[model samples]
Target: MRWSIPRSDAVDVLREQLRKQVRAPFAATAGMVVLLWASLTPSLMPRTALFQALLTALCMLAGYGAGALAGWLVRSCGGRLAGRARVIAWRVLAGVAGIGTLIVLGLSLRWENEVRDLVGVDRVGIWHLVLTVLITAVLLALLLGLSRGIRALGRSIGRFVGRFLPAAASTVIGGLIAAVLIYELAIGVGGNRLLGALDSSFATINQEFRTEIPAPTTPELTASPASSQAWEDLGRQGRVFIASAPTAADIGEFTQEPAQQPVRAYVGAGHEGVDIREEASAAVTELDALGGFDRAVINVVTGTGRGWVNENQAQALEFMWGGDTATVSLQYSYLPSWMSFVLDRQRAQDAGLALFDAVYGRWLEIPEAERPLLVVSGESLGSFGGEAAFSGAQDLATRTDGALFVGPTADNRLWSRFTEEREPGTPQVLPILDDGEIVRFADQPEQWDLPGAWEGTRIGYLQHANDPITWWSPSLALECPDWLEEERGRDVSPNVRWIPGVTMLQLGVDQFSANSVPQGQGHQFGTAPVYAWAEILPPPGWSDERTDELAVVIGDRAWLR
Candidate 1:
């Protein structure tokens, strides 16, 4: 009779156990907090106070929301798994079936476009997708495990500190410590090394591609003793591999060619034996010797880390000015631009600022009425470095008559500022400030219709929708970027969905694949520059027919090839 009077103890015990499941939510939220703190911010140095606060608040809310959803899912499903043996068996079979289904679906999915978008080849196999999925899954699982470990470690420390200090103080200290450790382990060691290896490997291949392209030469550059000595100094002392300029004969034959041949002064200081400042000085001397100041447009160019002066840009300027422009640039580093972006942005800034300053100082010495139009131009890392010369947009406006930066990196302070303070409702990718008064951005040729023909000193930033260099940032994890929310870039996959951790990883992969396709087709502005510059620095009485012709010639040259 007493045994039949069951004590409701079992029910009480089950309730207590269910209540203890609160830790899952806490753990998940803590893990998310650690991840957000460790990785989601773009840079430790916030560009502005408001932006920093906004990022923090957004991440915190996202982390908490994700944690709550995860907790709800776990709790809702926890009781369904009853007997341990049955639960284990179900898990095993479900895993097998899940994998088999994934394999079948992945093989069936049309991945040709995805592969082509990534590496410019449509020759992808089902095995490739399987392998990619496998690798990505492993990495993501590892990240989750690491985040969990961090949260556990932080909680344990917080409990320990709470014994000797206030609970709030203990929590704060524990969080700060966990954040530091996670950052060091996740970003400083693992991510940096991974990015470096990818960059270095690609650079080796890139260098081979560059070395194969024979450097152009002309007799006119080597005609006089002084010119030959300057050319020799550029080649020997300057450690330059290529120094080319159009001869009188080449310029005379312009009627047959779509673009007029112009003087191009380049000091190849890319290798280890070169001195940056010395080579810059040599480049200025060579340009002066070539009578560059007498040209209608004098362009101070910035090279990528590997010393590529973006021939597309140079060709555009030459065609615009009817081959009357003088372009001068010097090599700063031999590493690929992505490498320098990750490793040595300062060197680019130094080279760009120094070269422009030297050239500008010399240009200032000439009579204002007689001096050639002083213009500054750079692409990719060149743009990042070139913008370093100006303190702000106003500084750029005052210092130079015209500036054109193509595919400027996201971290470029000037680009960031202008984009932020741009006209309300203007797309970030193509902002038109003050009706294109002083600054304008263009994604393609047609979008360059500046109202009233912007008659004063102006700057144009040309960035494609698909260029990772223009869009990638740490904040992408928690907040949707403007580019992704609107029209996806031409090269980007339309099905590219944004998941929390998954999207961040995908973009990282995208950054590497950005240059895989031919230039102008992807990150390279092959023919776009011709169209972009035509709008930015349109020649007096320039016609659409001429612009189309310039594009055709620039595409035909394909100088990088």
Candidate 2:
């Protein structure tokens, strides 16, 4: 028979539990401190005044929010259990890190196209991601638990005391002040009312990013979109679309020997996609020099004084992805002189449009209306030029009676926006996979990852396995944005084995570094990540067991094996 304990005794037992919970984190605290110290790589330069001020302001506002979360946690979980929570958190973080390491290893080890296709490997394998999450949770939990223990021990909270608060409150207050200042004093600068005064802030914030390019010999640098198209149109029949992207040396980095190139890629071992940063107008000049294609889809190769460059090339190809294997590209021949962080992007988009248009016009001249339509598609930007080119093809397909859309970010807005501009329900927009399978960041902020009617259309999301730009967003990751359960064809979530190439999105960015600076330090994140072709694709039709010898052999370095 057990004797009943007094209320004081019960309280003491509860206290002991809390005390133990609190101690676990404390025990790990020294390890965490050592780990953090080892991982510490401070910024080379001093924090800017604005960054400092903002940080301070953020710290102030966060105080309240942190207090609230802390109170809530303590109340809900019983403060004594905090140590256990922290331990669990650390364990989770360790798990995630382990997973990430494994993913990296798997991707480098057992890689192939069919594996990429059927098993669904991406840049970071799912296991790797699991590890990363575990690591993050574990690290954070360890910190939290240690803090709780320290506080219970009557120690000072230190700088981190501010982190738990509501960060947005201070930001809102600061933004209001800044907005008021701009409106009153900076009116003329903001005159374009179209691109509000706030636009410059984004530019200024992004200006610190750096990209190293070899100095051009010609001071009079030019980027003619039409001209660029003419120069590159020569590669359509069998010219692999080697990455036109230039490295710091300002030279096309095609794989050395062609046949030994990677599968599903243009250039050789150095990586397939190009990173040319010429002027927006360069393609026009190149096209003019080359004498252009005749009949095209959206933009005529030789426009009878007809239209601007178009998006037909990509549209036509995507129109027939599995119909007949074809490679497409948007590149610049001569690096442009008028290059900036921003203009590099615009020119690439324009040049690509011109090339596609030229390609389309060539198709038109075939005069064989009986040609079984090859699938056509292209990735567009979140801006005007890409929208125009994409919309042009979309419109034409509707008129012609056949077209399809693929890629991570399909144009769902094309329906509502295009309809509003023209007649209601005038243009036909058929998203083979409803707006749900895989949504892009540029498409719609609200509908990301939401479920839609599942249709088992044979769809392929060519997500370059480890293209950093396409993955690991601080904002989107929290949402569980893509579908977890497969509704249609095989689950196409890329992993270590399966890899997506970065040719398309890389074209849209100006400088590779320009796209990567927000999250990472320098601009290294902007460049496209590579994978092996033989490694990424499903067993191509050409091969029996191994990847098609000729294709994978030739395209060897084109992708990462």
The CA lDDT of each predicted structure is 0.64, 0.29
TM-scores for all candidates?
Answer: 0.69, 0.32
For candidate 1, lDDT tens digit of each residue in 473-493? 777767777666666555555
Local accuracy of candidate 2 as per-residue lDDT tens digits, 1-561 = 999999999999999998876443322433333233212111111122222223222222233234444544555565643578867866875775467545543443233223333323232234533453345445455556644443443212222332553544443444445445556554444444423332343223222212242212221111223122222222221122222211222111222212111111111111122333222233333323333221122211211000111222221221212212233333332222112112334443454355445445544555576332322333322122223345543354432322222122222234224322432322121122334232122111121233454222211222221222323223332332222112222222233111111112212221232223231122121111111122112222423233233322223333210
Model 1, CA-based lDDT: 0.64
- Please list the residue runs of candidate 2 whose C-alpha ends up more than 4 Å from where it truly belongs after superposition: 1-282, 294-388, 392-482, 485-561
Candidate number of the best TM-score: 1
Weakest lDDT window of 10 consecutive positions for candidate 1 = 41-50
Question: TM-score for model 1?
Answer: 0.69
